[model samples]
Target: MKNSRGSLVRPHPLPESASRPVVTPLSPSVVYASDTPDALDAQYEGRVHGYTYSREGHPNADVVAARLDGMEGVAGGVVTGSGMAAVSAVLLGLLKAGDHVIGGNQLYGRSLRMMKEDLPRLDIATSLADPGDVKAVEAAIRPETKLILVEAVSNPTLRVADIDGLAKLAKDRGILLAVDNTFTTPRAFRPFEHGADIVIHSITKLLAGHSDVMLGWVAAKDPALAQRLRVFSVTAGLTASPFDCWLAERGMLTFDLRFERAQATAAALADHLATLPGVKRVIYPMRADHPDHTRAAALLQGQGCNMVSFELKGGREAANAFTRAAEGLSFAPTLGDVGTTLSHPASSSHRALTPEERAALGLSEGFFRVSVGLEEPKALLAIFAEAVAAAVPGA
Candidate 1:
């Protein structure tokens, strides 16, 4: 096949200096430097040259980073050992002793923990906002705010953030907008196209598809930023294993297909659950009743995704019963897998939160999260109905 302009795709070549003299290969010269007895600079190549050590760079990591770059539609990208590693890389890269960050109130628990712990310790500060509230985000900004971060789709609640709006706000404020795109995946929401300076994903979740590996990555338009982050990833020394990278590469190919089926199932399942007798509320992007449904319609390319959250009228008693009755279902605390997985966010993912904090985020003991899977929609519905019915607390 050929392009309309009749040109063949070609690989970018290494600079001339890199192709000869096995240029400056790392050795005992210094643990972190070239190991060869010969003076390292004698065979120097361009700065983009290969590893002086695996901590600096690795061929497999490069392969994974390029694959992630293509998926994220960015000028450059990097893979880290986990999602937090990528987040920390961006924070460490942009934040200084006195800088501050503004972020959505619905943050991953670890992120909340990090801010409450690390930033204060470093003399850097942070501001929190409900990303759903434009006014809240706007007001939270301080003169020291250097970044505004939000998840494209929040965990547990599945609140689809006002991505374009937040990105624009960040741009207007000269703040970097780094979006955590894990929940929505590249298939559901492409944040970079909406003005995000950086898009990060927890490849361990939907990206790997099968839940066999743990990896995270960041994609960005600025090659300089990407290159800088690549250095940070290396110096931080948390690059994914070569085999894990290989698995992620393989898993990414089937991402679209898997999520398409799962999303349909999710919609069906959520719709039915919402109509059930004891169901108080169902939160998913496409549902018209969702608080952010309008923003979801504008920001999400499709009708939400494969995650759903619902509250039971009976609170913790009903939630616990529903979980206990999940015989055939996987009652796991994890999300995004082939098997239908359920999690009780108030206790599992957000257990670290103070009662007041959990209430502020609308995550309560009655809230149950469901990661819909590739199973037939009807079967999922039947299982859900049966579980809910059997566990009716008042019954």
Candidate 2:
């Protein structure tokens, strides 16, 4: 097993100065600073040095991967360019042409595209089902099915899947179950604990916390599967950049603190939004009204995660008005940032879906998804209350 260049396959030795460290301990290296040509050779050879190329592997990425592996209780793992890349790697690494996959209809829009559009192009077939519905999932399985892809908590609409149930179904059928645990970090939920075969994370979200880094991670329950995933990442050039890895690792250090604060804020907001004048409905797993409140509570450790999806009574106009009036909140398309931000799925995340498709998923024109931040819940509630009052006509 050699990379494009013929480098010796050996471990990259630690720099002699590694013994010394700062107060917090930071291990950041652009390249494995070591004996030059031999190091280069070692990299090409995919040797024991821990990393060969920045694209294939790096020290920063290694730390993040290791930390994630520990948190998820995985046998091994790899970080990728983005969450989507991790999704691509899992499908590409584990399945080939003529293979069939069962994908959730509730996946993020781009993920849906990957399964609906890209998989077919690769000669792989996929059937979309409600990942939370055990019977529906079982019915969708085919003789050629090799994988079942699901999100622990669905995007925008906040549907929670039954990971343990799905895992049993997959195992009984000899199929792999990959759970995207991005929404609920390991602090809230670890998919592996539920017998998931592969756990995936869009480290860009809560794991990274700051929304500055774009990275993804795939943790495999089996070392052999991890090796295969690593090979796909290296060969396919889907590995994460070292700097992003460093940022992601830094983010993980305070993950518990950040997640706790944001999740609390999200729960409070969900409760408050239901009483707001312009609010039509609020959707959060913690809410008694949520479709999967009980299941989510059991699987997610009684945390609502750092997200809340709500609809404005005034429809799209009110949604737009609230965004325009909301002070200090960014109208960003992405989620899991340190600061509170509002994203409209009809216009951003699920914009690709046709009107009928969006409607089918319950993503209405007034739908607004809030990525709860670390702000004080009272202050955030004040801001939203004022914004809603200003936005809703005659309120």
Instruction: List clash counts for every candidate, in order.
Output: 5, 10
lDDT of 1 by residue, 1-395 (tens): 54654364533433566456422232222123454635455434554354556555566667767777777787668888888888888887667899999877898888777777887898989888888777789998898898888888888778778877887888898888999998888787788898999888888887787767788898667788877787777777867776777677677778888889989899888899987887778998888898888888888855578899998878788888888886678877777788889888787878989989898888887788888888877878988888888677443
Provide the overall lDDT of each model, using Cα atoms, as 2-decimal numbers. Answer: 0.79, 0.88
TM per model? 0.87, 0.91
Q: Tell me the deviation in Å of residue 6 in model 1.
A: 51
**Whole-model alpha-carbon lDDT for candidate 1:** 0.79
lDDT of 1 at 12: 40
Q: Which stretches of candidate 2 lie over 4 Å from their true place?
A: 1-19, 23-47
Name the top lDDT candidate: 2
